[model samples]
Target: MSTARQNPLSYDEAVTWIQQFSKSSIPRDQVTASFSRSSGPGGQNVNKVNSKVSLRLQLDRATWIPPHALQKLKTSPLVNKAGELQTTSDRTRSQGKNLQDCYDKLIQAIKQAVTVNRPADLEALAKIEKR
Candidate 1:
């Protein structure tokens, strides 16, 4: 449910965008997941099972994200030379858990990239100013 977005999103609007997408709005089709063997400790399972998750979302294909947030997301370090926003998680030995971790990381990164803090309004401050 991607909506039309302002070209330059204000802080409030960006917050709304994050809130909207934070919940399962990112289309699964636009994201690709790859699994690899994790190097961390987990007994024999670590060496044998492919528990690591590497999730990627191509910025261009992620139309569900607001335009301004997408622009900010493009500048994120997670974005690769191929223009894909990537997140990897091997903290857990379960592939499912790792995949969830990847989603959490992706969302957090998007939150950080999109959220811009607006300064306090001077007019509002003046109203509350003490003599």
Candidate 2:
């Protein structure tokens, strides 16, 4: 179901892809980023530079996402209360790593939205649950 090929994009590649997708599928004003202090390791530098990146996408303002895509995005765990898709990666002290991680997360989110299956009806559930 994914429009993306099976090549398995790297973090940088994924981010570029997401940016392009956003241009076509989401309003420019709907996307934003915030910097925060990263948790978990990284020593003293972590306390100084806010390496964590939070990518937010305001779904309600998006004109590009189809209705079905919007529904899937809403149900996805990636979305927050503000209807923003957030992703953070600070495993490494490097900002590049964190940025790449965020991109990968976004790519995964889109893939999820594109491929999600509808819930089965009660009759279908009954048949499966009976096993």
Candidate 3:
């Protein structure tokens, strides 16, 4: 067995993580992103600067995703694009923070995607709902 720890977000590991984490049935082309000017603070610099980041992940093409994972993401308030999730930050009035916020959102999305539900817990919920 390999003793290596899986680092999903590492620069070198992005491709591998994408393959494993995303639904295999979905084509890679489905995901896309766009960048635009971030609002708030930074005076005149902010008025002319594009500091915000937007990422869109297409779910329709993602055939490999499990139903539960899809349901969770669909129900999530933060999710967009019928499946896309977006995050933005202009707290520092710097491009760096905006970029970091985008990355942070991506990481959080992956973690949410990979969450596993225990069978027993689900069964209990089902019983409670019936009552």
Pick by TM-score: 2 or 3, better one: 2
lDDT of each: 0.84, 0.68, 0.59
lDDT of the structure predicted as candidate 1? 0.84
Q: Return the TM-score for each candidate structure.
A: 0.82, 0.62, 0.55
Candidate 2 C-alpha lDDT tens digits along 33-70: 67788885888988998888777778777545544566
Please, what are the lDDT tens digits per residue for candidate 1 over residues 2-121? 455545578787778777776387787889999999997699998789999999988898766667778888888899999999999999889999999999999888777777788689
Worst 10 residues of 2 by lDDT: 1-10
Off by over 4 Å in 1: 1-6, 123-131
Q: Lowest summed-lDDT stretch of 10 residues in model 3?
A: 1-10
The parts of candidate 2 lying over 4 Å away from their true place are 1-28, 116-131
Q: In what order do the candidates fall by TM-score, top score first?
A: 1, 2, 3
The top-ranked prediction according to lDDT is: 1
Superposition error at 85 for model 2 (Å): 1.6
lDDT of 1 at 18: 74
lDDT of 3 by residue, 9-113 (tens): 343344454456533433548656566776777788877887666656666555445444555666667677566655556665667667666666765665566
